[model samples]
Target: MRGTLGIATVVLSSLMVGCGSNAELKTFTITGERIIVKMETQDRSSGVAENSSEDQLVANINAADEQEISVVITRNEGSTEEVTIASGTFTDDKIVLEGSVKQWPTPIDIYVSRGNEEPMKLHTALLDSETNPNFVLLDFESSDSEDRLILSGVSRMLGDDSDKFTISGDLSSIHDQNLSLAVAEVRITSENPKSISGLSVTELLLDDSKFLIEGIAGEPFLVAIGVSTFDYAYWGHVIVIVEPGAQIEISPSATSSSFVPGSFASPLLAKSQIDESLHRKVIESWQNSKKYLAKMDEYARAIEKAAQPITLNSDVLAVWDPYYVFKELQAIEFASLTSIAQSLEDPMASLLAMEIGALNWMEYSRKLENWYTLASVFEEDIVSRRVIPQQEALEKQLDVVTNAKTIVKGHSAPDFTLANLAGDEIALYDVLANNELVLLNFWASWCVPCIDKLPKLRELHSEYRNEGFEIVFVSIDDAYEDWKKGSEKHEVPGVNVGDLHGFLAETPVAYGVQSIPTEFLLNPSGTILDRDVTPEELESLLVDRFGDIPGSE
Candidate 1:
């Protein structure tokens, strides 16, 4: 939950002589004059999380010097061809790469065998490069693919549907004790809990009076304000949960429903048995949320130290400190308690609350779309002999506008023209002819995840290219020259495409793409698996599921 389980023990003590035998896979260190690469673990359990962490890579780093490190992963994904060297560095998300490698950057891919018979290749491109002097901020729609970028990684926020909401934002405000916000309520008609999705939340709406929330499941304090009663007439305080990305509308009062348009239906409407199981899960989650509230201070500290404001696509958004933000989000998810999580005095709590709230707007949040937007409002009144003027506060309005509307997953990926090194055009839909799968990857040359997985991507392309599988690499840079340079430097070969759309807030907005090195897989027929898939798992899935489509060529 708090990242991957494999522990990393830094060796500062010289006297503690330890053997490096894993017993399962003998690990030995190979040191060069300036680099140290450790090869361990022959058998990687597929059970490992989607992200196993590149923190302590196939190599170690000098603590004092921020040197540009490249890990070359050569994996054999059940094929005779060994996936060769591709450049990879999780820290690329940290450093700013330049020069030749910047001109022709590395692209990488993770390999997974059909079953467990073959060892999958993890290739990293090693190049003749120089020191990177910048901090990595994630330029989501960047065309450059560096060994690292500015900001990095995904936000881990989940929820459960009970007419409750959680909000996510920069919570470090709590460190300075600056965060002071009230939780909103969506009044429900019935006292029984209504089901939504993953995240947990406080019952701020339960009594119409907002109460101060505290401690998650395992924490010290635990006392209930409401009755610990169950509704036997229906199921335990449970309603059917919402679908993957659907909103659950529970009216606080039946009369209020008329104020809102359309009928409120939950995608997660389950059968009677499902409703019962969901009720149990919600209870477990509520109990868990109470316990996690104990460590609010620690999480608050992490959030405060991690936030830094930056601009993306001419839009100013606060970028939280990557490491601290990543960990704080994990704590909330694992705690499995949204309500208690929100009560946290720390800013991380608000971020969790906001994230969950956005997930279920019908029950948890107020839609920022209509209530607030880039749309301008003019309230003009004639004063005595003078006319009062009204102006559009565009930027202020845009920041608060939430674009969380239902977006269809698997149709033809929207078409957009992106350039290549030669300024040629490539449209997304043009690539989707009769192919079973198309991987639309939005990456920059500096992305640690992108660079690290390049070789594997090359391998997948080569292996499946003849088989009717298609993949395109989209760069979100403004300059085609820089894109060309990074592509050449990385030795990124194949259908490499570049989109000048800085961050297609419109395109990715149309498709709800928040994070990157994100892979989208579609059946040849293109239904919505919209499967949130990773590269390594994808390779295995393709080989196993389709097993080479008949007309694949």
Candidate 2:
């Protein structure tokens, strides 16, 4: 079940070479034997992995450009455009790379390409100081030839740096010796994984359950506990400010999902206080809001059974009534999170505070400006440079969705055509021409809320069909098969059609469909009369127009 093929001979050496007048420059050298391995061969002809000359190996660093010609790190789905700190031609059977940087902790990416095609990433490392020369190895196993060749390796900051500060912690409380401890520079964006450097808990226990962290010190950092079985789910992180010769202690627990510092309590304790306060306040608010929501639901049912309109207490309208109580709870959390982030002394800590605030792109569009403003200030520090750019990109996406969602009532509805189940193109204008009003409903098959509203929509459609009312169901399903199945399964009663591109499709984007089950009532002239009309509101409006329900007394 398990086997090992020696693809490369890794060398161990430490040589500090000088580069020009850069006194802060640090040198890195990587030497290893390179061999090609094929996972799936129809004929099991070869006993060992094959070596081919067609495969090309290259290395890159996140530093100033050393070569005029660009060398981009091509990942599976996206490419990371980085400055090449070092460059060289690879020999047939070995990979030898030497690079120098003005900073000690720099990022390195190794890739392999074939026949002038895009380079595929093989490994990534956050190279830093180490006492002993670190060895690099990659292992992959697969029975299927069509499957992708998985690349696996571990990189760490293992060496000694005299100028660095140390943060020591005790793992005696944690009995799970199989866990892995990760210490990463706190980042605000998705690139946080790239900053991670890990150490084995079993190995740390060997040193008396005491873990030592020595890195580009005198800066704030975060530590997280990752379980081996879970592939290191983020329990939580504690902000530690490294002081020269200071012993900062951290207790990381998997069961409680807590990572707090015993020493240096200023930032961690403050964050804890903020989180605890927010939690208490949210619970209190949700309890009060639940009573009102329950009463309102009961009132809605009463009105539905009576098949008539009823006026409720006016006081209920003003109490957490501007929007859903859930929205109010989210608003409270984000406001408190912003306050906590602003109170932190370290930019990195502040960045991490905002990162874990659970802000979304489309839903929290209004907060994008403020987040961008905060990230701009954080990017002033060199340590935050690794993640700020990506954060800015995420915020930019929020801005785009925000702008798109701003399509309000009174605006002309954007018209578009799509294919239905019969492979016939149906235009919005054609539907508008026949019906006095059209409920243009944007939904997806995977959306539960979208499916939940279908029965009521069908009822309303049946009731109002004779009164020149029509419903057009637009599905933003990425797959045609899924769309066809969902449409047929739901027995969607409307002019059902799909663009099959999800939210990114033209019709969805034109109509600003950020969330599913978004509805717009368009008049025969194609002007949006209303948006986000609830099922109850739709019934009331139809009643007002048609006098009463046909079957109701």
Candidate 3:
């Protein structure tokens, strides 16, 4: 028997006539064996006081047919709690729940179940205020054979002034038995479970559980399911663009054996289309990449070690310096892997190349071009359509990279005047005129790394003051008082100025200061010599440009 599925969109009118007015009572009637409710709030307030005596919001679900049904509500806070209403006598069929929300944008999940059957889960986000609430209710029924599932729902937003969103779709083609496929049940076993415990699987691309193989026309869906530790520090994942009704199994090697320094390879151990030879090549490529990554990591550790005393103050520099090293090695890895992918007749080559490109892009935005190229190749050779929705996303990333490149080496530094603690205005060009070198240090008191680097900056100022070298501290603190207190407490030398606007400040925005503790070294002519260099790197550059100060080394 074929199943029928229908969806209805409905909007509920607002109970409040005007802003800050009393809310009128609202009621909803639900009639179905299985129900799913989704609610969204536009501008709900979260500061409402919670008083049990006061009436805030009330939701009631009554079983009109006097049938036994169970209701479970799950809250989506950091720690989730499931409240279940068991099926009972006639009076118990009607479930009434009332509560005041202390937090805005709280998502609640409701699961309704019948005798020994799977429960239907409904999702909704609640706002603290009862002024206006948006809700969507989905009702579903299933056949005895479980071959088909029928769905219908009403979406509604209360209040005439409410913003509405209308969504329409047909599930008629999806209900066809020929289009339905059993999902590939993936089982993973770690080679060394003791080393990496607490494993869980997360779907990287697809958000829905019901995998639609047919009746949906587009690129073949490339589902990337990641098997990682609970903390997600380690990596174990599989990528597959499977055919309809395909099943596969994967067993990941231990983290020590499988982890490439800068990449996550697919665990395509067993699949319908993947033969033993292709699978072996994929594993060999992954293992070979680890060797190169180890070399890169070794070089990085050496550089990190050479820049001694790896304290929190210099951690950013230590971390960033190695990335430059990794990028260089990654280029070589990309070339080698791309060659292997091109030589191989199987689809594994494209998959390997995609993984290489993805890892490169994560480290450097400039690699977006390379990733786009690989994605295009994957689309042409493997899927023949866009397997991932990254074309538009890559375009946006390219824009960000272009914007950030504005402040790179050889670019003229953007000038701005900000007020010092004495309320005196200091301009960037003016400082550059007076000193042979100026380091613009963007910092904040709340930033731990920024605070940690203060003493070292002070030391650098003392060591180079005589050589016409100066450090300018640009505080992005929201309040002048906090900036002043931090400045005076740390005794930060040189010209100390506060933007007060912090990230939104024009100077930092122009400089592309996305994160704190960003430092830029400028020559006397205001040309950006280098950016985000560690104190050790800055000192090395300074010493290389000018002889050591009169101090005996």
Candidate 4:
């Protein structure tokens, strides 16, 4: 509800659209939590109405803090008198502007004119004789706020010739009225170059060959491959090349007169070679889904309009995969950036660039079975006479990579360092710190079932901890604060540890933990006893398997 916020009054009225050619200003009031907002208007029926007569609402960030946020609303993009209580926030202090902005049908964006506050921020940790540097994911935490925000940035030297860098982001509250207004964003987030390190930008354009090369071969520029449009189904190609200068030549290969001429068929990919293909498919998906992406944004807006009232709850949330979006978007950006480095002029520069790209791409190569490629199995020497000998390393890692079961119960747990809410250092070793009967519970906050078993777990903890029992609760949610809040909300009475990782977490692999609420019971001797056990059934089993001494809870 963007038209206003925090007015201690209430009123409602019916307004209809199409009855008039332009939107009319209707006044209303709302009351709550020591805040005041007056009146504004929108199309009666639709949430995101773009009419000339309607009031154009704008909100500026007045205050951000632990308690609450305050924003002043002005009616009409130009007029400052109209006020609307766009939305309300009683507890969490998050606010969104409701109602409609006057410049609806026209593009409402402030990006081409970027303000200082919103551009990407950067912090560097290295300096040397090196002429080039690469970007990587920078991590930071806020335990006081009980959260972690992984700030993503690029690592590359800027060129004066590079007067303008292309990136993506929307008005912070484009989705406030309804996530559906994703249509409202001036720049879509996918366009941003994340963690740019060494890229050899070649122009990406459509071409004639089945393999699209916008420019000459070896020209390495970032390319986003995927279906073009829904109705005009046909294959498309782009040209690419790599060179050693601030700018390079670029041209599109060609376009198909028919529907999608290129068959972006990921399904035909052999199961064994899925890793590489899946990575590519996800990239193509972003390109292909541009329309749906906008539709999804519209969907959010539609719901807010009451045109489609959706039940906002836990069940409805599974579709909003921030983690999936974060990784896939980053991967798409990474692959494009990686392609640039691979197209460089210097052999070593090109080699190092390609290797880095390969590392990132390969990280996601095998997670899906449909995207594998034969290029990864190459025996060619990368640089300096050293063969890219990863077969042995791959073998060692693959030895443990079993089916989904190993994601749950593997032979041995891999060790990695992560932080707890208090900034205390935590790891598998820390969780298993010199304790007998270590109880490891892998679950998440989104998982309703996991919460259901908490009481039984508490009972087991109470009964066995006095007898040297211990419990380590590991949550694999991508959002750090969400995990903390969820744990607190559930009152999880145990040693809690999480990487703030989304699904496909590295920790899960190390412990071979596949399923949520999967309980691994280890004996006093640090030997695995049962990989599959329930909280209700665990207490008795522990008592029976390992004789309990008196005074046990």
The best candidate in terms of lDDT = 2
Worst 10 residues of 1 by lDDT: 227-236
Compared with the true structure, the alpha-carbon lDDT of candidate 4 equals 0.38
For model 2, residues 1-553, the per-residue Cα lDDT tens digits are: 1122212212112222333454677677654332222222223354222421122122222123221212222112114333445444434333455665555554444554333434434332445555212221221233321212111122334333433434455444544232232222222222343333322111121133334444443333333322221112222334333322323444442222221111110011111122322322322232234543453344323322332223573333332232343354456545555555666454554555455553442344444554565656654554255356545555555554764656668888887888888999999999999998899999988887999899898998998888888999999888988888888878799899998877766777766667888899999999989998999998888888876765853
Better of 2 and 3 by lDDT: 2
- lDDT ranking of the models: 2, 3, 4, 1
Clashes of each: 99, 4, 10, 74
Which should have the higher TM-score, number 1 or number 4? 4
Full-model lDDT, candidate 3: 0.46
Off by over 4 Å in 2: 1-405, 547-553
Please give the TM-score that candidate 4 achieves against the real structure: 0.37
lDDT of all the models against the reference? 0.34, 0.49, 0.46, 0.38
Task: Supply candidate 2's per-residue lDDT for 500.
Answer: 86
TM-score of each: 0.31, 0.35, 0.31, 0.37
Off by over 4 Å in 1: 1-412, 525-528, 545-553
lDDT of 3 by residue, 1-553 (tens): 1122222111111121132324443332232232321122222265222421112122333445334433322233233333322222223223333343333223233444444445444333223343222222222121212321222222222211211111111122221111111122222221111121111111111112122111111222233444332112233444443322223334332222222233432232223333443323543354346665465445535443433544666554544454565456556556655665454354444544444353443544544544455455443533333323334444544444455778889999888998899999999899999999999999987887988888777887888877889999999999988898778878889989988876756667777777889888999899998888888787787788677877624
Ranked candidates, highest TM-score first:
4, 2, 3, 1
Residue 375 lDDT in candidate 3: 56
In angstroms, give how far residue 375 of model 4 lies from its true place: 8.2
**Model 1, range 122-163, lDDT digits (tens) per residue?**
222112122111111111121221121110111112222232
